[model samples]
Target: MTPRIVYLATADARGHLMRAQLLVHALRQAGAQVDVITTSDAGQRFLAGFGIEASILSHHYAMQFDTRQNMLRGASNRNVLHYMVHPARMLRDLLRLRRTLRGKDILVNDSFHPAALFMGILPVARRKVVHVYGGSLREAVLGNFDGTKRRLFSHLFRHVVGWQIDAARARLEHDFSYAISDHAKGRDCSLPTPVQVAGPPPADGLNSAAIYLNPHFSDTNLAHALCEGIADAGLAAYCVGEGYAGNDGWVGVDPNWASRAAHAEVIVSAPGMAALSIAVVYGRPIILVLTEQPEQASNAKRATALGIAHQTVTWRGEAHDFRCQVRQAASTLRRMVPAPTAVSSGRLQAQARVDAWTVRLLALCGVQT
Candidate 1:
């Protein structure tokens, strides 16, 4: 019998949902019945194209500002109250999910929903797997610090931020956790979940198609810069998905990533974990822009550091330099190299790692994979 799996995710942003969708596809291909539980209709709609089943939960989101310097601001803080606001309803949904999977074998969490945190405390034992997709909170927290911000962060989180990560790792000890990058490891040296080195999508599939560019969320200023570069080059650029409005491009709302990506000459956008996955999966070269999010900045730096693509900072004052880099990257990509055997080998290694994880998760739930 196929294992029944529940994927927990958020709908406010498509990045996590997109990764979950890809994992769902992999699970189904491996003969598992997967149901994604998230908090938005938009997520459901996006997942529908992948033929994945979905359930909705209540959620709240805070607006993000333009710079990393702004993260120390009050608005950037997580509102613990928001999590408690719908406690009763979230509990109800958790029970509903249990009922939906009466004979199911596992609960896979990617969404960081409160229900995952409350697991094992419930009256009944649940075979659960918590897959934390982002980098280590330790890394993220440390990234937030960089000398000058360290004092500010210590004052804000009461030095409890790092402790929270330790606690989270402890709670998830009996569960399976997967990080998207190796940089996320080493911080939690004793991570309960088996760590794997699954890099984002490779950069080579770009071609003659007119690239439609969109970042992870709304990096409006970066979007404007990219659009300016594309338009000034006399290239027809297409914009879609979230945060594409008011920018110059063809109105292809609701990102059909699989299809739209095939027509992209180069994807010029911010380096989101999921967005990077799509770019690599489609073999698309990306002109990655750095963002204020600690994780995103890390990803941008890593990708650039690895020479996978070109990168630029949003706040950089040189528009001429920015345009020059864009055009040069585009021109170079016009004659980009072929996929090395190493790429397929790397992808196979990733699949193998994920397969091992699936088995571990199933076995933890008392099911044989």
Candidate 2:
């Protein structure tokens, strides 16, 4: 009998779905039957494109803020609560999942702990793998908050979110937890074990479609301001992972990168791991911007450290500032001397290890590794 794997990933952001899609492809190649669960319309569209069958985990959330954003006590706090009132529904759904996932061979939760924990409660023989991407395990290592504020937030986290994550991990018997960033491992104060770092996919394929990784909501003024900036910057911008819809210069998000990279001069968005990877692969200059989320801020910082692109404040609205930054980045490209067009040694080593680990995982799961 073929081993079956159920993968759960929240559609809170496109990154979650994107990573899960990759996992599905790899799992299928390894000869495992895969079922993916996602929560957003964007996730559904992406799954359709991959021809993967996916189930939508529906919930009513007002504003989707992750762990870092939960620290701020006022507006951000209000935003979190206003959006997090699905406690009863969440418990109910978890119970339902527990009943439904009674005998899967494996359950993979890619940054979707709630569903993972629920499935763990079932009397199933499946192994649980909690796959964490860049933002999943950030608190312990990147404690950039002030000392007093850190302590206070730590207390809340330990008592509240920390306990929840702990319970989820404990219940699920999470055998192997994977982290996307080697830079993020052993950093989170909450977990005892360092997550096995699985570096992202290599930047090799050239995407033809001009792509935009928009994590921001489409309606917000800030999102609008930034989208407009991107439109004005040059290439078309995608909003909410859809093709350019606005009358402004921005082209909505299109996954079909069929020809965008070849035609467009640049790809502008927050410095996300996936976007950065795409930029690197396509050799496109990125306009890194800080977004409302702290994790985004951190990612942007890392991208700048990696010499990836131009970084700017979250609320960069001045047209002149945008123009100057773009011009400067373009100038830098012009003056750039040609280095050996080879993959960096560090990246090559990382890729080799990750490939080995993927094989190991497939073998352990009896998937013909």
Candidate 3:
């Protein structure tokens, strides 16, 4: 029996969408049918690029931060203000969800969708909605906070934010919760869901066939810098992004970007939780995380601090410095043993956990894996 899975992912942050994508692939591999619903055009393109048709419902975005010179200054409280100012969006969102999702087969939430929050209250259960996290709120503050920011983060603010996380965890409590990595689980100590560390998913036979290397980017600015470096070096890397054009490298969208990332020789990326999780699953690829935002710098710092498989870089630094780091990363990667054996042991363990979820999800739908 093919289990029908409906994944509801919010696009405030793309990591959630990436996780939902992993779930979709895993479910389909197990012979399940899956559909995705999202609130961003970027999400739709991501799904379409990978051959996953997502229904787009452009809702008001949450967490619009004030960014300047490629740095996050602060987050806007517009979501709250909007609700207080006008209930139109909320009412519309509620009506659409209640109508379309009421009878759908098990819903999985990667973001804090109101549907997930209200599920347990209205004769429904948040446990019915699998909550996914690549990075938790606790990390957002603790990881990136400077001394002033830390001191300025009032007791009231801390209390309110902690309550929000706790409330979400309580609502979405389930026998198991999905964490992008063990590090995410470690940071989110309050998560009621016993965290299962899902390393980057296995290549699953999706080999990158002479397709040249794939360079991933969430930092479009850094992407341009890195691509410029590639061009200066006269290297031919595959640039992967919706609106990204390659310079000297070829620009093409591969549906299996994750798979390619897993098998690449060296990956130029950011240390965002999604990238870290992907690195864990991909194994052996030397990663040079392009640090731009505070959160990214923090993630990069932590990746290096924990001695996890990554190197950090500030792409905004001197372009020559950036190019030097790229060369250094590439050079270091060229030295590792051809095949991943010692590292494979850990990744295989993580893959087992992912497979365990696949089996459990199948069983949840009354199908035997």
Q: Can you tell me which runs of candidate 2 are displaced by over 4 Å?
A: 61-88, 113-129, 135-137, 140-153, 159-211, 215-253, 258-265, 280-284, 309-314, 334-368
Residues 1-369, candidate 3: write the lDDT tens digits: 458777788765555566566567778988888778997776777667656789865456454532212433344344644642466765566556556655555666666554454442444443344444435434553333344555565555555444444443222322112343332222123222221233353444432211222223333555556655544543445555533445334344555555555555455555555556555544644455443355556566656665665555555556677766665655555455435553355456446655655665565566865
Q: How accurate is candidate 3 locally (lDDT)?
A: 0.51
Q: Which stretches of candidate 3 lie over 4 Å from their true place?
A: 1-4, 28-33, 62-75, 83-85, 118-127, 135-138, 141-221, 228-236, 246-252, 292-295, 338-353, 360-369
Residue 237, candidate 3: alpha-carbon lDDT: 52
Q: Where does candidate 2 have its weakest 10-residue lDDT segment?
A: 187-196
Clashing pairs in 1: 201-280, 202-280, 205-283
Model 2's alpha-carbon lDDT is 0.48
Pick by TM-score: which candidate is best?
3
**TM-score of every candidate:** 0.67, 0.66, 0.69
Model 1 residue 10 lDDT? 66
The better-scoring model by TM-score among 1 and 3 is 3
Q: Looking at model 1, report the run of 10 residues with the lowest lDDT sum.
A: 169-178
C-alpha lDDT of all candidate models, in order: 0.51, 0.48, 0.51
